[model samples]
Target: TFCVLLAYGMLQQITGLRLQDSLGYSSSDAIKGTGALMTSSMALMACVQAIIFKFSVKNPARLLLIGALISVLGFYFLYVGSSFWIYLAGMAILGLGMGLMFPANLALLSLNSKEHNQARIASINNIGKGLGFAIGPLLGATLYQKTTDLPIIFAIGLAIITLILSLISMFPPRIKSVHKI
Candidate 1:
């Protein structure tokens, strides 16, 4: 969750720069491009979340895995994108993947916790998200100053980590078998 949110924050900070610098968007127009990305993000998030709630998906990890897979593709595209339209596509795809993951992530947090510990678990999770959000933009800015590729490449790396973690989360812990005497 932390890493994923961090990548998002980084993208939020860098998207405009990428537009203006790489794709020749005017500063104001670059901001508009960011707005477009956000719009697509919110739109997909709302639609996907609605469906998730409606269906009440039981296997949150499965959803997380699928979302992570999509996210990997999205971030990869963003890294390689040389044109404005491709960047927009990458952002929209990222949004779609996150939209699918968000609800599942929340579900897992609650589902995995006991009623007694739920609040504590949730608070910890939120703290991770908060820290990620707080740091991502700063990191993004720093990386952007160094090189545009650095930000997206870092984000792509984080998204891949998220995918690997999702895979790990998918399986249940195995119970050891005992031999009876």
Candidate 2:
């Protein structure tokens, strides 16, 4: 959750700036572009999540690594792209990635929790999200100052970590092996 949200924050911090500075958009135009990207991506994510929830996918980590991979592609596209359409497409792809991961994280939480403590467990998700979003932009901005690609690179690193974490979560508790006496 933190990894995903942090990636979002890092991308959000730079996309608008890229539109204005790199693509030579006017301030109004940049905002509009950014708004369009954000709204479309969010809508796509919501729709995808809804569909997943409707089907009640049992494997919580199934989409996690895939989503992270897709997100890496999206960020890479943004890194290589220099046009408005390209940027928009990149964001849309990232949105698809977000769609895959959000539900998985929630499902993981629900699967790991008891009915009584579900709300408490859920709060932890919110906390991870808040911290990720909060820190991402600050870290992103500093990295962006060094090089625009830094945030994307950092995001990719986080995605890799998400993959590892998701892999760990996918397994059930290990059983102790008995030795023959």
Candidate 3:
């Protein structure tokens, strides 16, 4: 979570001021409204994930997979957005996907893990997030520099990858036995 946050922070920090200046807008306005919008979506997603977990913690992967696919659609909206309303709408959907994945992934991992190894599992998951933060900016910059169409390329690529992951996640081997303690 922190890594994703950091990655987004870096993106705004690096590009927000410049983009605003280029567009003849105040620098502070560049990223000012995003947090408010994202927070609402995140809060709603947290509630949904909690409710879903109550029913079937063991099947949260299904939720994550679907969420990932939704993320792709959100990205598509963002990539082609040419107006404020469109951009905000895309952001709303993107935030929804993000919100859905976070808790759902954690719940699924917890369900699959042994209680004694919970800490280790969490640590490993966090490590991947850290790596994403550390690397996201460089990758983003490279793509941005490669062509003027960075957002579209990124949205398309993310959509493809998410779709693939969603497909894979849907087909997990069925657990045949339920152990009761």
Clashes of each: 0, 0, 0
Residue 174, model 1: lDDT of 91
Question: Who wins the lDDT comparison?
Answer: 1
Clash-forming residue pairs, model 2: none
Q: Is candidate 2 or candidate 3 better by lDDT?
A: 2
Model 1 pairs in collision: none
Task: Rank candidates, TM-score, best first.
Answer: 1, 2, 3
What TM-score would every model get versus the actual structure?
Answer: 0.93, 0.88, 0.70
Model 3 sits at a Cα RMSD from the real structure of 5.5
Task: Give the range where candidate 1 is weakest over 10 consecutive residues by summed lDDT.
Answer: 37-46
List residue ranges in candidate 1 displaced over 4 A.
177-181
lDDT of 3: 0.61
Q: How big is the positional error of residue 79 in model 3, measured in Å on the Cα after superposition?
A: 0.5
Which candidate has the top score in TM-score?
1
* C-alpha lDDT score of every prediction, in listed order: 0.87, 0.83, 0.61
Estimate the TM-score for candidate 3: 0.70
